[model samples]
Target: MIEDHPQRYALVNELHARPFPSLTVPCQAVYLAVKEPIEAANRDRERDLAHLRALLARHGAAHPAPGATHHSAEIGRHVLKWESHTEFVTYSAFSAGLCERPFDPRGSEVFPTDWLGVAPGKRIAAVLIRVEPLPADMSEVVTKLEDWFVPESLAASWVLDEAAIIAGDFQIDPAGLMRFTVFARPGTGARRVGRIVQRLCEIETYRAMSMLGLGRARDLTGRLNALDPQLSSVVAALPDDHRAAEATLHELLELSAELESLATRHSFRFGATGAYEAIVNQRIDVLRETRFMGRQTFGEFMRRRYDPAMRTVKSAEHRLEQMAERAERAGELLSTRVDVERSAQNQKLLESMDRRADLALRLQHTVEGLSVVAISYYAVSLATYALLPVAEALHWPKSALTAVLVPVTFGAVWLMVRRIRRAMH
Candidate 1:
């Protein structure tokens, strides 16, 4: 018998996880995404689970198993789908019906104000999707679109080989939720309708998440504005021969530290933004949209409005990196200059030490000469004293004897001192 890997089944089953909801036409879905404003990725998973439990309890619904990342349950007349993501949680409720008022927050009772008030995180995105069967006449959609969405920013398209006509303005309604309408062609499968709804929700969710970087980018721009001038001032002074290297080095280091802090603090947000942006684009691409009624498509809408904001984020990220690099390069150059100056000082110190050593050597020789002369004087005096008795017996002068001993004593002392100095050396 062959044994299976521990994760083999789980890994395979993951592909089937979060399958599209089987939704019939004339159904509507209310989707909400919640995320912690700070440290969302590392937020306590238990809190998210408890929040989900709270919602489930409201309808006397069975709770999902512990540690579940996604779940689906029947809550009254609606099917509630809950999913946990890296930094957020989403709750989607699907019901089969039409509301009397389209795109009105009060139209749905799935999310009560009190229940939403108790939610663990802030609402990152909310969407109301109304799916209807395609009408016999196309003008009905156009008429409803103008009434439902802001015409200046509307994006209407026929997607998935014209199986559905999807329209949205990418604007938040007065009720704080985005509105989308899906007109499914006749004979469209329930699963296909569900997929369309899901894609619409994702497009909004990821787009909102991606725009978070714009705020961070704005902050970085201000900081860069201040730091850039300080850095330039310091770098500009580097060429001045009168400017001190140490002072410039200190200023450069401060600039580098601030830039590093900025990069460290915002790296995750910028990276996440890029990933979310790519997902948004990819989701739209899969829709395979074509223009409907000479109106703009999702892609065109993003290119004009959304793309500029994304480009700003990219520009801010790039500018930060370049500033960091520039600071690093300047620091390196200043460090090298400081090292060269230290080397020059060390060289001069060594030269001074060599000159002192030479003078000391000359003084030492002079002291040795004086020492020999002093020692010779004492020796010669002692020799004269001993020879005085002989001089008296031979009737010779003491002065002559002293003079002869002086020459011999001085010569012997000088030779002895030379030998001693050589041995010491």
Candidate 2:
């Protein structure tokens, strides 16, 4: 028997998890995503599960297992799908009936007000999706769409080879929820309808999530503007500011630290923004949309309105990276200059020491010459005194005797001193 890997089953099940909801026509799905504004990714998953249980308890529904990332349950007349993500949680309720009025808040009755009040996080995206069979006259959809949405921002498209017509204005309705209408053509499978509904919800959810970076980008722009002038001044003064070399270096280090700090604080968000933006684009692309009745498709809508904000985020990210690189390069150049100056100063110090050593050696040689002359004078005096008696006995002159001994004594003393010096060496 073969032993399975520990995570084999778990990994396999993960792929099949969160299956698409099987919904027939005339169905409504109320979708909502919630997230903690700060430190969401590190939030306690148990609390999210608890919140999900609270909602399920309201309808007397069964609870999900512990550590579940997603769950689906029958709550009253609707099926509620709950999914937990890295930074947020989503709740989707599907019912097989639509309200008398299209995109009406009454269709979202599955989530009671009291249940939503105690939610653990803030609502990031909320949407009301209404699915129905396409009517015979396409002009009716146009008329109803104009009345239901702000026409200037409306995007209507035929997706999946005209199997479905989806429309939305991508704006918040008076009831504070995004509205999406999916009209499935005849013979469209229930699963296909459900997939389209899911995609619509995902598009809006990811779109809302991705836009969170816009505020960060704008704030970063302001900070960078303030820092630019300071950085420029420091760099410009480097050439003439020899006295302030250390001070300038210090200032450059502080500036570099700040830029690195900015990068650290926002790197995760910027990276996550790019990922979410890509997801939004991919989701829309999978729909394979074509323009309907001259209205803009989702892609075109994003290019005009959404792309600018995304571009702003990208521009800020690029500018930050470029500035950081410049700071690093400037630091390197300054460090090299500092090193060169230090080396030159050290060379001058070594030269001064050499001059002092030469003077000391000359003074020592002069002292040695004086010592030899003094010793010879004493030797001659002592010898003359001892030879005075002999000179008297031999009838020799004291001056002549002393003169002869003077040269001899001096020569002997010089030889002795030289020998001692050589021995010491």
Candidate 3:
């Protein structure tokens, strides 16, 4: 799929195919894309002519013929020289111009903005070179060019497979494509060298855009909690679901996982680690907010609901205990009352039984007294009858005897009543 993309694949192939001049010897190059139609091309040509005239004037070569004078300008300590070639100009003078800038003395850094008329999709493209004279041994020139242009720190196995056409191990095809045999150089210093080589090799516009993208990513990540917020918003704003959120997230994660993938591919590093650290710090902020919410919710639950429920339970338990104690006390009081009532009832029953027993004893004593009186009266009647017989025989005082017997009977009845009372006692 990537190969089918003409723009991307063409660009990649061009980068690989082009001959990267040796930076150790100082060189400059530019890749241009022409955008205007035929009519606009003429205007672009006029503009280039005017720029050339300006260069000549600035370098004090204004009176020289168009093809005769090579304009040269002093930029800082280095001299920049511009001359016409068959199809392009040796623009290495621009680098010299950059070196002359006020801050050039600080380091060997190239600033693209210092160029006079460099822009994307311009009508023309060119590079320039000026180096210390090449070594007599052509092999040494090829070796040095390979080392200067391609740093081994980035690719340990990047080698030209074909045999060298040049004695110095450099080969060039008819299309102006040059290849060099390269080997890995391992050391801590190799990293710095690799970086320098990458900058030298890359197109200025592409490198600048990449830096802008990284800056944008950093700023966006800084404001948001997690990458999710940025991702979701971007996904939502998209025209369709063709840019799948899940897929995008996966891609993002993959990008993050292989932190050095792009750097490795470009043979350059783009502050990726620093950007990732910023993202991590943003995520930590999100985590802190989540933790705060959790703690707050739990605290509210405890304060407003759970604590009250527990207090209610405790109160209910206390009330139940009080009720149970009250019931127990009531039961004890009732039991005491019942015992007192039962004792009173028993005392009444005992008093009624004693009265009945006393009445029964009195009735029995009266019956015994009556029986004794009856017996004594019968004995007196028999004695009276015997006395009547004696009187008839004697023919004297029968009436007087009967009277005496009656009195005796009376006396005897009274005595018997007294005797029965004594026996009952």
Candidate 2 residue-wise lDDT, 1-425, digit = tens: 99999999989998999899898998999999999877655788898899999988888889999899999999988989999998899999999988998888877767778878888889999999989899989988888889888989999999988999999999998778999999899889999999999999999998888899999999999999999998998888779755567788899999999999999988988888899999999999999999899999998999999999999999999999998898898898889888988898999999999999999989988988888889988988899899999998999899988899989988998899889989989
Candidate 3 wrongly placed segments (more than 4 Å): 1-321, 339-369, 385-402, 406-424
**Candidate 1 off by > 4 Å:** 381-401
How much lDDT does each candidate structure score? 0.93, 0.91, 0.38
Off by over 4 Å in 2: 241-243, 371-425
Please report, as a residue range, the 10-residue window in candidate 3 with the lowest summed lDDT: 162-171
> Local error of candidate 2 at 309, Å?
0.4
The true-versus-predicted C-alpha distance at residue 146 of model 3, in Å, is 57
Against the hidden reference, what TM-scores do the models get? 0.94, 0.91, 0.23
TM-score, candidate 3, is 0.23
Best by lDDT: 1
Query: RMSD in angstroms, all models?
Result: 2.0, 2.8, 37.5
Error of 3 at 163 (Å): 66
